[model samples]
Every structure is written in C-alpha cells, then in structure tokens.
Target: MDMWSYFYTCLVSVWLHRLYVYSAVAFGISLWIVIQFTTTRTKRKGKKSHRNPSSPEGTSDKVGNGCAPRQAQEVHVAGVKIFYGSQTGTAKRFAKALAEAVTSLNLPVEVINMGDYDPEDGLAEETSSRNICVFLVATYTEGQPPESAAWFCKWLEEAANDFRVGKSFLQGLRYAVFGLGNSAYVDHYNTAEELFETSSEEEAGGTDSVVDVEDLGNIMGNMKKAKREQELQEGAAGAERREMITPALREALTKQGYKLIGSHSGVKLCRWTKSMLRGRGGCYKHTFYGIESHRCMEATPSLACANKCVFCWRHHTNPVGTEWRWKMDQPELILQEALEKHQNMIRQFKGVSGVKAARLEEALAVKHCALSLVGEPIMYPHINSFVRLLHQHGISTFLVTNAQFPEEIRRLEPVTQLYVSVDASTKESLRRIDRPLFKDFWQRFLDSLKALAEKQQRTVYRLTLVKAWNVDELKAYADLISLGKPDFIEVKGVTYCGESSASSLTMANVPWHGEVVSFVRELARLLPDYGIACEHEHSNCLLLAHSKFQVDGEWRTWIDYGRFQELVREHQRSGGSRTFTAADYTARTPPWALFGARERGFDPLDVRFQRKNKARDISGC
Candidate 1:
C-alpha cells in the first residue's frame, strides 16, 4: 500500500472486506443448520410407525411370544429394541413405560422378553437393521441376572469373547443397558449393570436418550412407590391391606372358577378330577391311596396360611398370619356351599372336550375331600366340625398343614391322612424355604411333629425337595424323620409354577422324575423302618411308608374309605374318647400303584396323556 501509507490503506480495506465475507459465511452456515434441524424435526413429528399414538399402552406393540400374533409395521426411527429381563415384574414395567414413551415419538418399538428372544438368531438382525437395543435387566442375590435374562446375559458375555460369533458379537452394535434394582439392594444390581456396560463399552455412544412415561413420572418417584409396595409386601403395612379375602381377591378367585364359600372357604375343581373324568388317570392320591380322583372335592375351610413357601401353588396370594384373625364361617355353611359349588363346576364340564359323561356323573357325587387346596384348614376355628361335616357327607378327608401350629395339630380330629409339611430339615433351611411368620416356627414345627406322632390316625411328613435347596440334606432329613417318626413320608420334587412374584423358583429347582427316584432311593437307605412304598412318575412324587403300612411284604398304603368313615363316626359318637387306629382302615396297595412298576403309579385302567412343558396342579397337596 502506498509504500507505507498507501500499503496500510490497501491492507486495511482488504482486511475489512475479508472480515465481512467470513462473518456472512458463518451466519449463513448457522442459519442453514437451524432450518435443516427444524425441517427434519417437523417431518419426523408428522411420521408415525403405523401405530395410533393415542392407543393405550401395550395395545399396538409387537411382543415376541411365539403364539401371540405380531404386528407388522415399517416406519420411523431405526427401531427401539427393548429387551427386558424381569424377576419381580419391575424391570418389565420399566420396559413397558419406556416403550410407551418411545411410541409417542412415532418410533417402531418392540418389547421383547430376553427369555423368549434368542440372541443367537436375532441379535445379528438387530445390528444389521440399525436398531438401538435397550436392556432393562434385573439382578438378584449376588449380582445374578433374573432367571428370564440369565441365558441372554450369558450369551452376550460369551459372544463378546467368542471367536465364532463375530457378526453377532457386540463389536459395533449399539446398546444401552439400564439395570433395575430395588432400593433395598443397590450394589447387588449395579454390579450387573457395570458388567453389562463393560461388555459393550466400545459400541455405546456418550449421548443417551431417556423418556418418561406418564404414570412413572421419574426414577425417584417410582422408586418411592416401589419402596412402599415392598413394605406392604413385607407385611409392614398389613393393616392397610384388606381382610384375608378381599372383594378383589374374591372376584379374581371366582373368575378363575373357584367356588368362594361364605367369605372365607373356597373350593376349586382339581385338574386331576378333570383328568380322571376324561379317563386320563387319577392323581397321586388315587395312586398312593384309595381315594377316587373323580369323586374328590378339593377345598379349604380357611383361606389363609402361616408360611410363604417358595413353591406355594396359590403364588402366596392367599392371606398369611401367625394366628387365626379373620371372620370364621360355620362349618356346616362352608361344607354346604363348597359341595354345591364343586358340583356346579363339575356340571359345566358336562360336554367339554375330553369329558366323559359317566365320569362326570360320578364326579357330581363327592366321596373324598382334599382339605389342602390353598390354605391351612387347621387355621379355621371349627375345623374339627368341618372335618365332621365332610365325614357326615361320606367324604373322606385328607388335610395338609404347614406344621406351624402345634396345639392345633393336637386338637385336630382324626383325618383319613394328616400331612405335616416338613419342607426343610434344618432351622435355617426351614426359615429360608417356608418364610413362616412365627418367631418360634422351628419349635412349633417340632412340637407339631410331636403332636402328629400322638395321633391315632395316619400321619405323614411331606418333604418337598427343591433342587440345590433341600436335596443335599440327607442326614438332616433323616434326623427330622427320627424326631417325628411319621407313619408315611411323601417326598416330592418342588413344582415350578412359572414366573411368580411370590417365589424366585425356576425350572432348575424342579428335579427330574429320575432325579427324584435317585433321591428317594438314597434317602430310603438312611431309615431302616421306612420303606419307599410307591412312586408317582408323572407327579415326580415318591412315598415312604412306615413298616406298619407294609404287611407281610405287601404295602397297605391305600385307605379303606368306608372303614375310615365308620371309625370317624364311632369316634364322634363316643365324644372323641374311642378313636380308631390307622391299621383298622388300611387297604391293600395294588400292583400297578406300587413303587418301580411299569405304570409308575398311573391307574392302568385309565388313558395316559403326555403333557409337555406344563406345570403340576399342586406342589405339596
């Protein structure tokens, strides 16, 4: 410029011009960015993944059950794959809420159970489809994943390190893991989350997307509610809950085809009754004893129990208490309604599939009563009279008790066979398995056994063997048997009821029929006097009869029902002073019903049907 001045002036002008152009370019670029963002958002808002956003939650989503029809849709975000593993339904709920929130954004979302979803086949598809996989995983004791997600988590961990599973392995696949845990045990669950994060550390982006469902406002609020629920479940707010039998529970029971009698007692038609009515065979009782399954009424005088056993068939929904507190219905009224309702229910199966007309007619005339349906019948104030009422109707009674009440056991009138649940041998094991409400539960259990030993009628110790729980305590179980000296020992594999909040029991806990036989065979060697009387293969149950039930090398496990009823009447007439002994009503055990037979305790006269992957009707009954 100018030499000094001219050059300075030129330089200033040139510099100013360059500055103006640079500023303009920067502004234009910023404006373009803003417009592009707005347009993209507007377009996205207009688009829907073929689902009505206004529809109720869980109405339109594709859940991956093999039988449920899946909805076909194509639109919106890459996809939201919500893979949930739930133990107590909390993680499942979180996944549902998140799915609902994502749906509002017009995103194609799927809520899949990790148990149902095979990572081996479908995980690669997620990566190729450009979907963001979200894991809502729940972990329990010792940082263990929920049973539903165990395979999933294990697959992921192994695949991440496995050389053969390259494409499916989470190398570039995007994922977000949200660990679920109750407030009670934070660290236990966080360990699971950390482990998952470490497994997928490479693929996860720094930014995360989180949306809240309307009902579950925030994590803290949801956690607070969960705490309250947990407290209620722990019986801290027992009074806040309704009576033993609430209207809601009553309605639910009625819907499930239960015969609710007099606000307390209930009767449900046993599946065995249905089975025998169809000539499919009688239940274990029909095999082990002389009770006709088609003619048995499964009922309970009390709708309450004292123990929260891990394998409770009712899912622990029935009320629990240490003592009787609910309104007690008269024995006569309960029996009347139970029989009427049972007969009415039996009538409905008149023309149903696989029902036999002749057997249906036989089922209408109740001859045996199983007072072990849902609760402790002994808890009823007038259970003795209830038993008497059943006997008066010519219904032989087989009652089951959890052995929490010793005095009640002593006062209980003679039943055809009285069962005391010896779920575990040791005190610690019993506490873990039964979860009894009484502080002196162990003592009460021992005393109940003592009381049972004094009864003239047949007495049994029911051993429900849960694999990895009580199966290894051979010596301890033998010790308990010595203490009670029960007339019979019924050892059964714990039945898996399938995904109950009341228990964390999985299919693993259920021992195979062969395994049950192995256990029974081993246990039989420990006791010299008790012999393995019979085995019900279908039920995975084994019976050990005292030497008394074995007469001249033949088993007399079956009950003489007519003789038992006669003895019950005699005892009643004599004011309970002249009770009869179990031997007086003993009946000969048939060859087919004996242990290690080809029929495996199934009545050879009846048809046999194989049910695959179905749960047993009762665990300990």
Candidate 2:
C-alpha cells in the first residue's frame, strides 16, 4: 500500500480492534451484572432472615451466646411481658406470636400495647417487679418510634438525662428491643436510643426470624447462667424449698430497715447513709475513700450469711449458710430491686426535718454500692455480673467479704475497692468471733488474703475490732497484714447489737474511741508501708493507708470517683484487655477528711446533731 493509504488502513484496523475489545468488555460486564442480579434475587426470594445483626466486639457489650440452646434452670421468671409499638398491625402480631411461643414453653406472658401505656407511671413499677419486658417496635419513615411508643421514648431519654427522673430510673429492668421493620432503619429500631439488639429463641410462626434462648437467657433473664449452675448442681438436695430469706426472716429484716429483693438480695439504708441525707455526717468510707455516703446504696445479693457473729448490728437474725443452696435471683433483678428499694427508703425522708431537698435529690440517684450489708455478698454466684450492673450505671462498687470465699475472691471482677474482713487476726480468734460455717474457714481466710494480694485494683483489710475478742492479737494481725500488702487497713469498733441468741457480746465488748486509737497506733508501729491515714470520729473508725498513697507527704487516700468510672468504662470498652491499678484513679485527701482534722473526718458542711441515748450517742448520730 502507499504510505498514506497504509497508515489509514492500519489506523482503521486498530480502531476496529479497539471497538471489538470494548464491546466484549461491555458484554462481559452486562453478563456479570445479570448473573449477580439473578443470584441475589434467587437468594432473596424464599430465604428468611433469622439472625439479628450483631455489632462486633467493642461496639457494644452483648451478654448472651444466641447460636446454641441452653438447658433450663431452677430459677423461675418472676414476670414476663411482650410489649409492642406498631404503626401498622405487624409489630403487634409479632408480639402476639412471640407471647404464644413463650406460652408454649410453659411461660405465661402478657402482651402489652405501648400506646396506652404511660411509661413514667408504669415503667418504674416494672423494675421493682423484676420482669422480662420485651419490646416489639416497628420503625416508620425515619429512625423513630411510632406515635404509640413516643411517650416511652421520651420517658426513657428523660430517665437517662433529666436529673429529676434520676439517671438509672429504669435500671435493673430486663428488656429486649426487636425491630419489626427490615434493615433500612436498623440503627433506630424498637426504642428511641437503644438499638434493636435481641433475637427470639422461639420462632414467630416458624419463620426464619428467631432469637436464641441462650442470648435471651443472659441479657433478658440470666436463664443460661442459672441453668449452668443447675447442671453443675444436678443431684443437690431440695434447692426449691431453701429460700435464702424465708417469709418470717423477711418480716424480721423489714422491721430492721431492710427491703428484701428477689429470693436472696437485700438493701437497707445504713445509719451513716441516713445521717448524710440529713446533712448530719457520712460514714467512715467517706473519710477514707471519699465516697458520698448519702448517695451510697448498702445491699447484699446473698442475705444468707456464712457467720452468725455476736456483734452483728441486726442481732444476727439473718439466715446463715455456707454454699448457695437456695433459689438464686438474677443479678439484673437484684440490681433493679436494690436501686428502687434504696430510693424508696430515701423518699420516706422527703418531709423529714433535716433532709435537705438537694441531698434527697442526690440520694435518689445512687453513686456507690456498699456490698457490706448483713451477708456474704461475694458468695453470690453472679456477683461479677451484679458489679458490672452497678458500674454500668456509673456507680462505684465496694464489695466486702468475710474472708471465707478465697476462690470466689480470686474469680471476682474488678471493683473500685475490694475489702476482705479480717474479723480476727489469729485462726482461733476468727473461729471464735466470725463463727464461720465453712470447716476450712481458717485456710479460706488465709487464701483470701493471698488472693487480695494478687488483685490489680485496691484491696482493703477491714478489721471489726471487738475489745475483748480480737483486739489483743496485734502481732498476729501485723503478720497477716504483711502478707496481704493491702492498700488500706480499716479498724473500727464492733457494732454491739442487742441481746442475741447467736452470741453473748455486750456493750462491754465494744471498744472506746480512745482504745481503738491506741490499738491502731500500736499496730501502725509494727507495720511498714502503712501509716495512719484517716479517721471518722463519730464512726470510731481508723484508717491506715499504704505508703504509696503518700506522695510527697500528701495522702492520696481518697478516690476520684469520676476518674474511676472513666477508667472502668474504658477497660470494658477495651474488652478487659487494659488493666488499671489503685493509684490510677486516686484523688488527694481533703484536709477536713484527714485523720487529725477538727471535724475528725466529718465533712465540715454537715450539721452535727447530738443525741441523748447511749446507742445513738455512741454510734455517732
């Protein structure tokens, strides 16, 4: 060909080849798109979606394993309700079907219409009822609850934000949110704030949509943990009849200022708690650890204690046992009951003379939980879960054990502070005073101290010194104190409750404030890395803190509660990968709260009331 003709011919051939290649590529793309469409359509045609989307680990905490079924347990559900809020009738239908399935499982469930329900009036009641309230809500155009459920959403957000309603107003209520709509508004299904998180174990009309009972068991009602415990205790004898607090015992506890929760847990306002509410004084904990006593809830999950100590403030009328053979209550239920009960008791003081409205408002929202009331709190199987519940509510945990459950202490989750009751220094002394049920109590006590030594968080050696019973064993206590290397040592006079069949302890057994001080002074000399830290004069309580808390001559005995909360939340966010020590959240001890202050560790802002009676006077009222 000629040069120009050859070039044009070559260019035309190249253009034709390029066009062919582009056509083939476009054809392949079209074919692939059609194949994908066909496959996706086929997959979507008849297949049902059973699985609820799970936010991966660290996004949010999910409690249950829904992939498998769990065995049933002895614990019975107190209340069951299937709540629905639907624009159409779809969510209501789902609720009815789920309720029917639950009924098939021999569980009686009430179907609720959220539209007619006043959450502010009825929601708080549900918490006290300890019920499993399931929400079946359908999303409308946006990520919002239907008009029927608008009141609930508003109430819930208010419960969280509005201080008047209290931050944890609906705490301890076990409820799951299920979205009736498809995945378009998955993020804002069921409730206004809480995401649609749970699935059903019992299918709705045998569709693919189902939530595993195991997952429901943990987050909903704790059936799985109970079932696991039941399986472990298969051949145990007569667990049903052995309620922790019998009806008669409940009457006694009620009379003694205690409100019983579930079958086992109990909450009572501490005298110190009452005092702080009236602008009187806080407890020794406030002096040593900077805990706000008025806002502290004193509760115990297991009211069946291990000891019938002579000095028990309630005259040791509580049930006594070693292992938890009684019907176990769920931790979430216990938490709910505790908060409500404590708040109700505080509410009773609303019109009382000295109760400041501000303190009353503050006390309604619990800040600290003292698991030191009338029982072995750590003995509860689900103590860790209970602690988590408290922490999740922005409440700090101060769990006190009678040094009887070493393995339990080892297995316990992190707390703001862990206290082991060194009721007596010597083995013989412990046996005489604590009157422990466990035969290997002495070994358990020693092992408990060792476990406390291993804990990353703050550990305390709590000594309830009875003048004639345990005070003379200073050398022995010194040796044990060296072994534990605890962060703080609390020495307080034993509370002398009236005549008890349990023991012959009298007012004579209780030490004077001077005697306690002298004893603490002598004990302090023998111990190293420990010195007198703080004291609550009215409480007759002396605190000895570790040398580490003393930085450049300033005592860091008090806790920065907000910092502690932040650290714990972050630790949980990190999935427990990160560890925090006691020093991390320590705050500087205020001068007035120190041992040698004029007010003697009592907050200066409080008004002192002098009572005439011996019990009231000596007890620092």
Candidate 3:
C-alpha cells in the first residue's frame, strides 16, 4: 500500500507540473497578442499625431500632407491701396472688384476697409512712393461719411489742427477719390472733395495731386462694370441711364430715397402722395382742378429747362437746353415710360403698414399728370403731342412753364390747367430771380404772359414769394397779374431747403404763412378784378380768382372736369379750332374750398361740408 501511495504522489506531481507548464504556455501566447495589439494602437496614434502637426502634443513636423507649410501671406507694402467706405456694401464690393482688376494687370494691389485701416499709421509713407491710393466711398445720411469711415473723415477734417499731420502732409501722396451720392440732397457729394481738399490743402496751396487724372475714367468704368454685374445677378432688366448718374448725384438722390426714371426723369414720393396712399389727404391741386391728388402722377416730360431760377428747387443739376438740341424722345415713348415709372413709384408702398391697399390700387391708374416736376415741361419738343397723348388716355394734363418761351406757350394746346411761373414783379427782379437764358427775357416774359391771357383753358400765374426779394413790389406784381389776367394766382412762400451757392438766400428769406397771407391781401387790394378764392395752409399757399368767376357772389373756382373733357373732345373733333374758354366749363366751388370761408379748403372728412350740402353752402357762404 505504501509503495502504491508514493507512486500516485509522483504521478500527481508530474501531472500538476505538466498542467502548470501548459497554463504558462497559454499565458505567453495571450501576452504576445496583447503586446501586438498595444503596439499597433500606439503606431496608429503616432501616425495620427504625425499627420496633424497642429495637435496639442507639439509635434515637430513642419510639413503638412508631404508639402511645405504655407508661408504667411505677404502684403505688398508699396502697392496701390484700394480703401472703401461703404454703408450698404456697394462701395466695398466695388473696391474689391477694382483691386482684383488692378491685380490682373500684374500690379500689386491691397484692398482695405477704411473702417479697419488706421489712416494716421504709415498711410503717408505707403502713398509717398509711386504707389497710388484709391478711395471708393459712399455718402451716408445728411452728407456724412459711413460710420466706419467717420473717424478717417473726421481726422482729415481736423488734420490742420493735428501737429503731427500737417495740411500738406499728403503732398507727395497720389490719391483719387470716387464718391457715391444722390443729386437731390444739398451737399450730397461735397464731402469727398472737402476731405481731399482739407487733407492736401489743394485749394489753398494750388498744388494738385501728381496722380494721372486719366485713371479716373478707367476707375469709373470698373465701378460701372461691377455695378452692372451686381445688378444682373439681382435680375435687373437693362442698364438704365440712371445708373450712369454721377456718383455724387446718384448718392444724393438715393440718400433722399427717390425712385429715378431713366437718367433725367425722377419720381419722388410727396407728402400728399403718401397721405393719399394712406387714405389720409390729397394734393393742393385736388382742390383746384378737381384732380384726384392721390391718383396724380407727379412727373416731368422734359428734365431740361432753359432757365435757372434762383428759387428753383432742382439746384440746376437738370440739363439746360436753349432748344431741342438733345435727342428728342417720341411723345408716345415718353408717355409710356412716364406712366410705367409712375406705376413703379406707386408699387413700392405695397405691404406698408399704413397704406390702404384699395387706395394704392386706385393710385396705380394715374388720373392726373403734374408736369410741374422740377423742369419746364414745355421745353419738350413734342409738348403738344405729349398733351394729346395724355388726354387720349383720359389723364388730365396740368402743364407748367418758366414763361421764357413765348413761342412754346403760344403753340401749346389747351390743358386742364396751364401754369406760368411769374418769378418776379419787375424786369430787374425777373432777370435776377428767373435768370432767363434769353437776353430779351423781359420781353419774352411779357409775351408769355400775353399769350397766357389768350388761353381758353384754365390759366394760372404761380408766384413763389421770397421774403425781402420780390415780396416788396406789390404794384409791379399787380401790373404783371393784369397783363396775364390769369384765372387764378397762387401766392406761396419760398420753401427754404438749404444753403444754395447759386442764390443769396437765407432762412430769413423764407416768409411765414401769415406773411404770405398779408402779402396776398395787399396784392388783392391792388387788383380789384381778382378775389381770394382758396387757401392751403399746409402748403403755405393762397389762390386768387378773377371776379368774373364769382357768379352771384358764389365762387366758381372748382373745375367741371367732365365738361372740360367733353369740350376737349369736341375741339378735337372740330380739328382743335373751336377753342373752349374757362367759362365754358365752369363749376361751382364749395364754400369750404373758398379762402377764409371755413376750415381751409375742401376737408373731405368734414361731415358738415359734405358734397350734399356743398351747393347750398356755395350760394351764401
């Protein structure tokens, strides 16, 4: 038994040893596998770290994807600097496109935003070389630079005061500026010139920049190309001449937010137009000519005029023509364009909070055309044809002339209302105020007035009174009024817009409504044949009608529109020889429409003065 036990122990020991050896071999195999997996993961991580040199581990590989790392962008220190001061991003985009264009010419170019660039730091040094500096800036609100460029402009303005930067510090600098602005705002494009002049002292020193002025045309062409591309991308139809407007003028008009038509014609939204769009009010003409002021298309047939009146609101930017020297547009084309532009102007108010959709729709179908928009409409070569075209469309025509062209007025067809601007009372004042082109302007003025007196349709003498200028000559004004013998006289105070270099006018020159009332009263006292018929307080205007229109103590100032159209048609049928007079289609004027009778003129909302009681009130009131 003892021998068997010892043998069993030996056997168990041998098996245990073999089992331990087998377990050890299996553990070695597992260890080898674990070691291989760990090595593979470390190799993968090492490869990832090598690929991404920017990793936080700070790897020393200066190459990326088997290529040398990109060097820092080199800036051309002496290259042309294209700086832009943009409000709506147009100027900036233009600057970028210009820089690209210049670079394509193999010239070094650097585009910059004026807002980000420090003008005081190395600007003089950079521009001191043969390098040029180009500024494409836009005029912001009220003739100021964009907010980003305000600091630069202010610095330029105060450069004279800065001891470090002298007035002629930019003397060696070659620079050109392109300003974007509208023509409507006074001093619209005046800021850029002021900035350049102030910084360089060019006006005082009489030393101009050595930069070639020839480059200006190229720069303008590039800007135009950029604008066209942008417009095309935005689905704009054709390249309108309005796009060709000078940067300054375009900026000014754009600043004032005018919807331009073509190059010359403009469609400005008036307060009356806005009021009418909101179903609030109408224009002053609505009371006089029975026109729907809301449905009135305030536009001009010809943007060119012969005269440059000191009191003219257009600021003389419009083309001045002695005759039909310009490319004369056909009457049909003019009418079509004008109507389309008018509709476009009206359409912009769509979806506005206060605008009545129904009234807006009504406004789209223009019922009246005020040709008094900024120019002498009669200067259009086809004036008669234009008038006929307007009438054929059932649109009443109210034409205004500067009284410089007697022949034009004589040949003009009868309109719903014809107005001649009686600028001044005396010949000297007329010469100074009207600033007529004809040397014999006084004779032309007299002849024009005489021709106006013979007109069968409604004739008006519109007198714009500038205090301390022509308001003193009451007898002279009365004499001129007698010459024209107009059916109505509009006495209005001069609206003082701003400082005009063309005229010696100040805010003091503009009269108050009370002052206008006093002047009109004095004038009415001088002319016994005329009576104060109507007043528009908001416009600071008063109307005087001839006594003959006052039938049985009732004023007949309001026009019979239907009867006038009938007479016009009849005259057209009779070959336009059988002319109609103002009395032929006289309509009774409402009492409220008469001056000093009730609450100003024709309050459409006045329940007491409804159309039902208008006739009964006219006889007594």
Candidate 4:
C-alpha cells in the first residue's frame, strides 16, 4: 500500500494533469483557427475595406493614358488586328487584343502567331499579294527574327517579292506594322524590327546610282557622327541626308559593297524610349530594311564584353554568366559567311523561279562593310587589323564604342567617322547612367573624350538624353563637352517601348523639339565655344561643335572622299598598324563643320502615318 498504492495514485494524478494541458492546447488551437477563418472571410466579403495591389515597378499598364476610366479589360477594341511573328507569348497577348478589336468592328480577319504556322511551306505570292499584310514581328538575339518569323520573313524578303510564282507577287500588298521591342534588348528590338525593307543592297553592278536607304545600318549614328562629312561630300549634289551603320553592319555591307550615304543610311542603336528616335520612323524603319536584305552572318561568334553599362539594350537572355561564346571568326571569314547567308536571304526571297540570274550575278559582286552591329566592336582583340582588311578592299567602316576601353579607341584606324557614346555629364552621373562594370570607368570615359578631341580623324560624341533621368544636368553636360571638344555632338532621346516600357517613362516625359532646343540653348550659353550647328526634328536630336574649329563659320558640311581614300591607302601600306594618339590626330585635322545647320522641326510619328498609308507603294517593287 505504501509503495504500490502511492505509485498508482501518483500515476493517476499525473495522467489527469496531462489531460488538462492537452484540453487547454486543443481549445486554443481551435479558437485561433476560427478567428483566422472569420477574419479571412470578412475580408473576402468586403466587410473590411480592400485595396487592389499596386503593380510591380516597371510593370504598369503600357497602353494609353488614364484620361478616361480604366476599361473593363486592357484590350484596345478599335485597334488593327495584329498578326505577330513571335516566339514568346508576349506578342501573342498583343495580337489577341489587336484581333479582338478588329473582330469587334465586324471586320473579317485572321490574327495569326507565326509560331503556329510553318515557314517551310512557301506562301504563294497570289495569296499574300491580294491582302494587306500586317507584320507584328519580334526579333531574336543577334538581329535574327524570331524562329517563327525567321524563315517566314526570310522567305518574304528573299523570295515572296518575286513576280513569277504568283504573277503579281507582293506588288499590291499593303501592310502596317507595330514592332514589339524592349530598347534594353540588343538585336532588332527583340526581333520585331526586321520587316521594313527587303532589298537594300541589291546591286545590279551597273551605273545605277540609286542610293539605297535600306543598306545603311548606322543611319541614326550617321546623323550624329558623320553628318558633316556626308554634307561636305554631297555639297548639294542631289539631296544630303545623314548615314549610319553598326560595326557588324559595316562588315556586312562591306561584304556586300554598299556604302552608307547619309544620316538615313546607317544603324540606330539605343535602349528603347520615347523621344526623337522612336517618334521618327527611320530608326526602326531602316533597321527593318537591313534585316530583310541580309541573313544574320555570325553563327558561332564571341559573346563576351569587358564592361557592363546600365543603359545597355541587351536583354536578360544575353550571356552574362559566361565571358565568351567561343568559335571566333576572322573578319574576312565572317564577311564571307555573312555573304553566303545573304545569298540564302535572297534565295528565300526569290519565289518559284529560285534565284534570278541577275540577282545571283549581283550577289557574286561584293562592295562595302561596317563593324558596329551588336557588341562593342572595339572589344574584339583584332578590331584594328580587321578594320584595316576592310579598308584594303575600299570598304568604308564606322567603328562605335562606349569609351570603356580608351586603348582600343586610340589604336582605331580612320573610318568614315568614329563615334563615342557619352551618356552622362559628370562622373557621378556617368556611373548612374552607364553603370560601368569596372571601377575606373569614369576615368576611362574622360580619357576617351580627351582622346576623341585629339584624334585627327573625325570624332563624334553622342549624348543620349533620357527625360526625368538626365534632363537636369545641363551645366554638367556643358562641362563634359568642353573637355571632349568633339567635332560633332549628337543629343538624342531614349526610345520608349518594349522592355523599357516597364520603367517609368511617358510620352509626356519625352522632350519635344522645343524642350530639346531649350536644353541645348541653355548648354550653348555655357559652351560658347560650341554652337548649336544643326537641328533635325525628324530625328529628335541636335548637333553642336566648337566655333573656332568650324571651316567657314557657316554650315560646314562635307566629306573629303579623296582624303578618306588616301587615309585608307596609308593604313594599308603600314600593314594597318599605327599608334593613333588622339592628341597628334586632332592637332592637324581641321574642324570640318561649324555646327550651324538650322533647326528644322519635324515629327517622325506623323511620317509613320504616311509610311503606313502607302506601305505597298513605298516598299513594293
């Protein structure tokens, strides 16, 4: 009784205590669950006021503004039916809404995604010729159209224009286009910008002095870099426009023997935004043209870079984890492969007749080249020697750089004109805007500016203006300009669309001509040495240069073709090797232009309406 009875009693008391604790825990848990359920239900029923979650930064509604109430859906019910040439689903969403709007209007239409169709099946010219074509294309990396649209666009450009397969061909086919792109993307505005021109460099090898607008890849850059040189060359010959081309395009065009003539002839490279570049249709217009004419040349090219800038147009898909893509090719080999690819591009365009004998013969004869396409061409170890090789063939080259590597810039040969993109005014602003990968990028940029000032070759400083971001640094900009003393200064606005639309940009934020004039005018006061030489409203940019450096203090616009040719010969004689100290070069090179070209206020968006309205007449053969 003392031991066993006590042990049993103690056990019973302990069991009772345990039961009591368990009951209390269970009760508390039940109450908590009940409370949570009641609160959630109350919120769901709107017993408590609820707020819609705000969209993540850079993911706001990209359609029209909020002057009216938010519509039932994000779709624009009155827009054109979009047939997107896209690989990803983004273009699909855009096309769906576009199709819905067209459907609402009771218009019989087909809203097609290129991926859903087979590009291998040759589209009959009669089928395509009868209808108005609407191309909503998205470009892939390396300026290649999306896989879905790739073969389709290739076929369309290289073959669909032929009159034999379907008689009339694309002769009467009218079309409108809306390219979906992110300026952050590098190639073809994410591939949508490959639809404007089909045969920019179709040389018949005769005395046909037709200047092809589609052949120029650096047309935008030309307006900034080589406008004066071209103006000097043209000298009111017929009409003078700016020419631009990318380095890659330069290489390709060299392989093809097409020269960038004026501001409208070259490549327009930038991050997407709304301002002068996009408002004017030419940026993408000419780009669309280039993609059509040439198949992307480099297949297994290097994809490495030394610096990573903030305002880069490259997409997230770019290889950031790795330093290179290996399988590098010589410039001449790259040019050869590119030419072969170009033939394929033409073959795809040539319909049932296959390759026209004339076209095939023309393809055999090659001409000029450019080097500024996607990556920083200067970063290539063999850039100098490669440029020399093109020069040897009378191929004009335009080398563009971010000024990240001044040493490369110093070693660069005399091309048509060299471009250095200076994105900010001050060191701090430079860091904020360019977001350099290296610690000493700011210093490197300064050295580049000074080097550009010193170079005997034509040096241009390109300043891209992003509203609300770099609009306030007028004084700082003037200071930087003073240091560089560039022959030409091109101030352009960011293109707002695609990936950049995710950021805080508005049409209102896009500085108008008046705004740009005001800013440049202010900077002009500080930069008394540099005058506002010319203004092009269609491009949404301005040009400035040192007054003392001007040739006649008037609009000094001319390119000494003879001089350029002489320099090429000299470069070749020296094994394309020369230590180009910017200091020594600029010392003897006279200022070519007064930067006094008048301000012509024009709107490119308005021109787009005209282009779209007369699409067939403008693009058709």
Identify the candidate with maximal TM-score: 1
Q: What tens-digit string does per-residue lDDT give for candidate 3 at 1-621?
A: 999999999999988799887989999999999999999999977765454222233323222222342332122224577888876677888998989877754567888888898887857675457566888887764457877788878776676567755556666566667777543334344466446545555422346544432344345557678976876765555433233245566667656655555555555656687776775556567665556777887777666676767777766666565665344456777678778877887898999987888888998988888888876788777889888888888888888998989888999988999999997989888866776666577898999999998888889999999987898999999888889889999988998777654455788988998999999999999999998988876578899999989999998887777787888988888998888898987888776667886556645542222256345332212
State every prediction's TM-score relative to the real structure.
0.63, 0.61, 0.58, 0.45
Query: Residue-wise lDDT of candidate 1 within 359-422, one digit each (tens)?
Result: 8888899999988998888998899888888889898989999998899999888888899999
Give each model's whole-structure lDDT: 0.79, 0.77, 0.73, 0.50
Show the colliding residue pairs in model 1.
1-6, 1-7, 2-6, 2-7
Of models 2 and 4, which has the larger TM-score?
A: 2
**What value of lDDT does candidate 3 attain over all alpha carbons?**
0.73
Winner by TM-score between candidate 2 and candidate 1: 1
lDDT tens readout by residue for model 4, 232-277:
6676585533223435545654454332222112222122111112
Note each model's CA RMSD in angstroms. 12.5, 25.1, 20.0, 24.5
The superposed Cα distance between candidate 1 and the true structure at residue 400, in angstroms, equals 0.2
Q: What is the lDDT of residue 353 in candidate 4?
A: 38
Q: Which order, best to worst by TM-score? A: 1, 2, 3, 4
Q: Which 10 consecutive positions of candidate 3 have the poorest summed lDDT?
A: 58-67
Residue-level lDDT of model 2, residues 356-475, one tens digit each, is: 899899999999999988788988999988899899999999999888888999999899999998899887787667766676778988898999999999999989998878888889
Evaluated at residue 584, the lDDT of candidate 4 is 28
Evaluated at residue 244, the lDDT of candidate 3 is 28
- Candidate 4, after superposition: displacement of residue 72 in Å? 54
